[model samples]
Target chain A: MQKSLLIDPGKCTGCLQCELACSYDNEGVFNPAKSRIKVFNFHDQGRFVPYTCTQCDEAWCLHACPVEAITVDRASGAKVVADDICVGCKVCTIACPFGTVNYNQSTGKVMKCDLCGGDPECAKACPTGAITYVDADWTGLERMRTWAAKTDAGQRATA
Target chain B: MKYVIAGAGPAGVIAAETLRKADPEGSVLMIGDEPEPPYARMAIPYLLAGDIGEKGTYLRKSKNHYKDLRIDYLQDRVKKVSAKQREIVLDGGGRRAFDALLIATGATPIKPRVPGLDLPGVHHCWTLADARAIAKRAKKGADVVLMGAGFIGCIILESLLSRGVTLTVVEMAERMVPRMMNDKAAAMLKRWCAAKGVAVKTGTKVTKIEKSGRGLTVHLDRGKPVAASLVVVAAGVKSNVGFLDGSGVKVKQGVVVDDRLQSSAPGIFAAGDVAEGPDFSGGWSVHAIQPTAADHGRIAALNMAGHPARYKGSLAMNVLDTAGLISASFGRWDGVKGGDFAEAADKAAYRYIRLAFDGDRLIGALALGLTDHVGVIRGLIQTGVALGDWKQKLMSDPHRVMDAYLARAYA
Candidate 1:
């Protein structure tokens, strides 16, 4: 069963716990600038969306890494950046369409979600369950259920 | 059950401690993204002003106190979570299965996408790193340009001014702390800032921030370029919910949770700055203060542990320290439209009080400098005391308001 994150934007209060968890997991500091997962706040719309590297089956960040620093973790299916191998060229950061991968000035290394080997701290720290770890293959199950519930099935004729 | 808490901010650490207290036999694990344990983000301004030292800002429960509680304090962040498998993946390819999970990820400072915002001397005051950066450049005679005159900006200005740093505040709004203070209170604060030699420019926008030699030049909308050795951007913060893209947890402005702080998913919960819970005073409002965040952590942890606790909403009380002056505001100040507006001001004493109302019910108030009757006004607001004959006594002696209310409530 592949594990995947389920995000509910309505539950997100723009808290950076996930970022802090990501940063502390990777950078050893509570620096959001260094976190792989970044929360975007649309103030006018009153929305908080946590965006990160989705670990796409065919990852752009991995292909863009000239040094081959980005690699997929077999066990967790996470695309991770190997800091020692990374050249800090920032080519991959631009290559990614989603802008999930970023360059950290202090470390001069590119950073993105590594999925914490599979047990995501952001999911653990989330008080509202806005972020959840679930079966990766069934990520759309919740949405499917919602739409299924909305399906207008007229009441069956009385038995 | 071994509990793993992520993020060492107030929400994370408080949850860890609460878990220890609730289930003494349960093992606790705290993972901090920052090198330092949770320090008071609220006290950073005092540290910048030299009133408090680096040690004073520490909000930790003593060194290795988690060890005493038999809590495994992991410095690493959890990279992945497998809810079906009941395990968490660590950064270095490690996994830890947990009986329950609590996410207390706090909010991060919003760094706008303005050009040159990432340049040196540009900083935000949400973390120790930001504080240290600003403090390093805030020399004895350095000129500092602060963007955003909200709570953080005003507090940082007060701290910087004490160190003899020339300060200029640039706010896009018409008044300072406009969200928290009404027009009347804002006017009083503006005058106070002016009297203290702080240059406050409201309704002004920062067009560009460019590097000039060792210093930086901040170009304003209708003024000559203001050069500063340092610049602090206290614009505001947004929830740190960016990692939930593929995660099936529902989110809006914040991680939307019901009164129980439970999200759409099972075995997962969010609190602190990340989770938006029910607001009793208003309809489903999210509060981003430290006290409220602490409350969220406690309530969420209990529910996660099967105690079935519901979070009662928190009051949005913003107490500010502007130089030596203290300003505290609570509830809705705008509710008081037009019943009576009364004030007592002394420029020399720096003392001021302005009260507004709608007939009998107390609506809004501003207390500045030093007033002996602040407690009375605060109590009246808290208890929802109708003015009755109290309005007449308030005009002559405001302290009588509290005395009368206390007499009635206790009577």
Candidate 2:
């Protein structure tokens, strides 16, 4: 079965370990600014939401790519940007509604989450288990289970 | 089904790919005048900046991507369209019949009628060859006079600046990016560029260009003639619809298309800068932006594949990074008649915002230096959400746009 990165923002601690690990794995640095996965800190809400490419089945970046630089990796089901082919027009960055894809000024190429070719570093480094690589089909499994357990409790209390 | 796609730009490339996927056995042919592989014209600026090589400008990375996909590519320009016969005559003296035709012929650069434009060192930065020629002469400390400060002109600003050339941007308009932004925002952009040491000559026009010793002299309407090693014309582009003459296709500023992206002539569709498709603001317009081109390609291809898709109309949007100052405009940014307009500007901080609204619905937006969640403005405009009381909050304090967006979009 294909796997996907499941993220539960409620469990996030805003520690940025995911960001650090991501940057290290992809860029060989610990710079959060350079990380593909960004932890957006909502200072007013006191919440941190780690966000990256969702690897959409019909990705806007893939469709918007003029040069056909963005392609779906068969093994990972991830939209991977071929750095050599990317002309750095930043069209993909604009095309992404989630704004996950970003332009790297130094390299003049757009960068996004590649899911680490299979094992995502962000999911691996999440201390709070906020991010996990799970079965793509079962992404909603835990949420359904939680709702089912609540319903079971309601039924038991009524009985 | 046989599909013929004219112009190998973004629109044509995407349509060809989409057609291939929809009909694996269908015959598809893409024709382009440029000798090189399908390349993004927008990336030519980056090419001038020395960021990417010529290969990087190509639309597809692999050399044999089209061949692998069985999509035939022809290196020839479309000279005439015989709509009745459903055939296009190429400039190289050949006619090809097609079941469906896509006029994605894009646009041609508008070079101002200035003498000595034919001289060496003078070029239009529209193609790869142009970029190479510009790069050769646009050396460090080289005097480069860029004629026009519109969207394309502003885009190429950083590239020329990065080349370490002494640049002078001449715009006939009163301010920079006149078409994209309002007066206030344009004035701010001019100031910002001036601070960056760019000689911005606004409200000026280039009258004549004369050959000088080892350089060229540009005569303007007002200021002293600027001596330059290179004169790069970024005067903007016109639709490449010259070949569509007597084609029976409805032609306005561009090929007029219906919601299905079908032209006046059935079995023929148009996309990209060459098509005067529907606009979000309830009119037909040529939105030459890249996103529109991509969207048009997909929708047009879907219809070509007999999927019967309807285009939701193209939104006029532009996000420009002038040197470092990021400015974005969306939809009908220059307010509508009987519309409520709100704006906030911080000249010192290099920040600005202008929101246009019709009743409670946000229609357009413009921002400079306020990069954080600027997409929210686009979202608000696109969704046409009822801002309600939050509209007043935005008018009072535009910085709360993110908060307003979340409150409205999520709520």
Candidate 3:
């Protein structure tokens, strides 16, 4: 079954462990600054939203790459940067609507989350279950069940 | 041919790549002082934001990026250059010869001569080592006092805030980013940051930093002393032009270069922050932005490769995302002498646009919370396109820039 990282921003504690884990897994270093998955803190609102490349089927970064540096991972459905091929032009960083495909100045290549070769370190590192790897088809199963339960209560009250 | 590039910053790296591309048989030696793998200083802010790791800051990712290209990368400081002999002496008593030399030494963060600056808690967020040190002490709920609210300082505020530190920003200027922005635009930015719970002290200076008990105390020019665990000095930067002294390379605020980026010495070129080349406004100024540096690298490499490439003066442009507010400035953002100005501000939407005009040409612009017209503004200014009748319309309604641009260019 295909897997997806389902994120619940409400459950995030802003600890940045997911970022550190993702960076470490991909880069072999404990640097959250280089992490593909980023946690944006809305401090005034007291909200933390961890964002990353959503691995769109028709990725903007893939198409925007002039040298075809960005590619799709067939197995994980992730968009990855072929650093060797990237010319460091930064067109993909502009093409990405979500601002997920960002340019790495050090490497002169654009980078996004590749889901850590399908295991997805961000989901595993989340302490509060804010991020979870689940079956892509059944990601909304819990939400549907909640609405169904609400409908049943409404019908019971009407009866 | 032996090509030596003194400085492995972005421009230097690009120069090496370009040189290698054009002259496949030539030997390229890229030298930098920093011991770490060639990295972008701009990425440090992202590092502070916990966006990527140290490896993410590297200019080339794949193993053997430079090695595969056959470019020699060295991490040795240059003490001086014998420009007359086309030789560079390393600090460790070594000499390297060059047929073509490009100086992309970049800049160094200025450590202001302030009392108690040598203390343990005070740090300059410039290098990888500095980032690690800052990450250690700038813990969640830690009191952090950041000196200087300029472009560099303000850029890192978001990252520091993300790290969950209690931030207090002190700026010597009346407003933030004084070099790039006007009072109104800077004021708007400061208000936006303050509204988001950031403590902004404008036109303020840090008199001294003293150790108070186990923590530290930051004395300000005005108001009460700020208690802090971490004090980040984000004051300013100066060009890396020291190695060229007595080399007859010529120096102003930076190494002086011509339109070809060629210095006084034959076969010597300067690029990036170290080179004070021509500015768009008829004078020489160092545009330290990344895009300009990339252009410099390309042009310098082309010239070195025996291709004639003339650099038409660099333009000053900066786009900043402070907290949630996005702001940008381009060209002579502060209107020139006797230049007409058109401005529009929407306090409710937090949208603003100010257009600078010299005669009929679009000279410069300031924008806040408006990203759609950025490209058009840049294009019109760079081209020096005459607005004609559309100029009057823009003067009345700056939001009609798209329409004016369409009418002028296409219509």
| Chain B TM-score list for all models | 0.89, 0.98, 0.98
B70-149: candidate 2 lDDT, tens digit per residue:
99999999999988999999889999999999999999899778777788888998988898889999999999999999
- Write down the worst ten-residue block by lDDT for model 1 chain B: B402-411
* Most lDDT-accurate candidate: 2
What is model 3's C-alpha RMSD?
15.5
My TM-score estimates for the predictions, one after another, are 0.66, 0.89, 0.74
Per-prediction DockQ scores?
0.01, 0.16, 0.02
Model 1 per-residue lDDT tens digits across residues B178-285 = 877766567778888888888899999888999999889999888888999888888888887675655566778677887667776676777777887776346665
CA RMSD per model (angstroms): 22.2, 6.7, 15.5
Better model by TM-score, 1 or 2? 2
For DockQ, the strongest prediction is: 2
Question: How good is model 2 by TM-score?
Answer: 0.89
Q: Flag regions of model 2 displaced more than 4 Å.
A: A10-50, A104-108, A127-129, A140-159, B370-373, B387-393, B400-407
Score residue B184 of candidate 1 by CA lDDT.
58
- Per-model interface RMSD values are 24.9, 13.0, 22.4
